[model samples]
Target: MDTVTHALIGLVLYKSIQTENLSRESKRALLFTAVAGSEIPDIDVVSQLWDRGGEYLMWHRGITHSVFLVPLWALLLAALSWLFWRIFDKRIFWLGMLAVFVHITADIFNPWGTGYWEPFSEMRVAIGTVPIIDLVVWALILAGFLLARFGKKPAHLVFRAVACLIVLQFASQTVQGLAIKESAMSRYDQVVLAADFQPGTYKVIGKKGGQVDIVRTSLWAEPVLLHQLTSAEEADLQPLFEQNPEARTLAKWAPMVVVEDTPQRLAIYDPRFFDRGGSFLFESMEK
Candidate 1:
């Protein structure tokens, strides 16, 4: 998910809490805890500044986003809240934990994925059921905000309703993606589904031997082929790896990739991201 969505989710979580009886200082601490915990995992972005050997690819969304680290993050934020606001409350720690957990879990539904298991496992667990910036989620959150401002209902109830709707959206997308994958499996050895900006639409990537097919699909229509790609089965990546370590990192980060090797260049990229004449996630080296 995008940073804006994460921040909004943090605020939504804070709003969901019943704060009518809390002191003003305690309220401020809870707000800080929610926002901080939600955004803290992304602090791994700083690793790029110091990383030189393509380690940033592995480090970003790594340990900081790990499930095991959620409690630690909550504890740290709670301690900071107490130090800064002098408001020591167990509810602050729980709110912090919920915020951080939401951040990590939400990323799993997006195509970019997250290292949920982290140090324990380097595997990138992405369901690819939702776009990185899902407009549906944005709309839902916006509606929640509007209701909170003008509706007769309680603000906490409105936010909770939005949260339930978000969960339903995730469930619907996951089922649709799985169905597409199941259909693709009839003809391909491997299938990957990447959600599109348009709701209910997806980019279905299917691979068999060295051939990869990119198909645009939707619940209401049959799959349509957008591109056909050929992977270089004979390409030796050691040279590419030695010259551009990021190539190796890309191979590890993506669920599957199509390797391209020609006399002039060597590259590997996730076919699901292929667009125009290139992919955003591509890593290449001149031969």
Candidate 2:
């Protein structure tokens, strides 16, 4: 999820809590825990500033987002709350855990996955069932806010319902994406799915040998061919990797890549980001 969505989720988490009996200072501490915990994992973005090796692609959403680090992050937030508010409530730690855990788990449903297992495993668990910026999630959260503000129902209950609806939406979208992926297995050697911003729609990318196809698919409609890409299977990529560190990093980070070999340059790019005849994740070496 994007930073704004994560922040909104943090606010929703805070709103879902029953804070009527808490002191004002405690409430402030809780708010800080929720919002900061939600955003702590993304602090890895700072690695880019020091990434002379061009490994920022693997570093972002890396170990900091790992499940193993969740407890530690929560502990840090809890201690900070204690220092700031002189409050030692266990709820602070628990809420921190919830916020951080939700942040990492939510990231797994998108195409740019986090390193969930971290040191235990380097696998990037990208389900790609949700877009990075999902309008539906925003709408659901907004509805919760409106209901809490104007409706007769309790704020906590309304926000909880919103959370449940978000879960259902992700579950439904994932199931449909998985079905589309499974159906494409017969046609390709490798397959990946990226959910469209519009719900129930997906981009199904399949690779068979050197050929890659990006297809737009939905539960109720026939798959429409979007883009066709070819990889230079015969091209020697070792030189490219040796000369361009970014190329090596791209190869390791991307689930699969489309290789472009021409007289002027040799390039490899993640097909998932292909748009307008180019990709933002492309790495190349001049011939």
Top candidate on TM-score is 2
What is every candidate's alpha-carbon RMSD to the true fold?
A: 1.0, 0.7
TM-score of each: 0.98, 0.99
In model 1, what lDDT does residue 192 have? 83
Which digits, one per residue and each the tens of the lDDT, describe model 1 over residues 124-209? 88889899999999999999999999999999999999988988998898898888878889999888889998988999998999
Q: Clashes in candidate 2: how many?
A: 0
Global lDDT of each candidate: 0.90, 0.93
What is the C-alpha lDDT profile of model 2 across 240-272, one tens digit per residue? 999999999999988989999999999999999
Runs of candidate 2 with Cα error greater than 4 angstroms are none
Clashes of each: 0, 0
The alpha-carbon lDDT assigned to residue 178 of candidate 1 equals 82
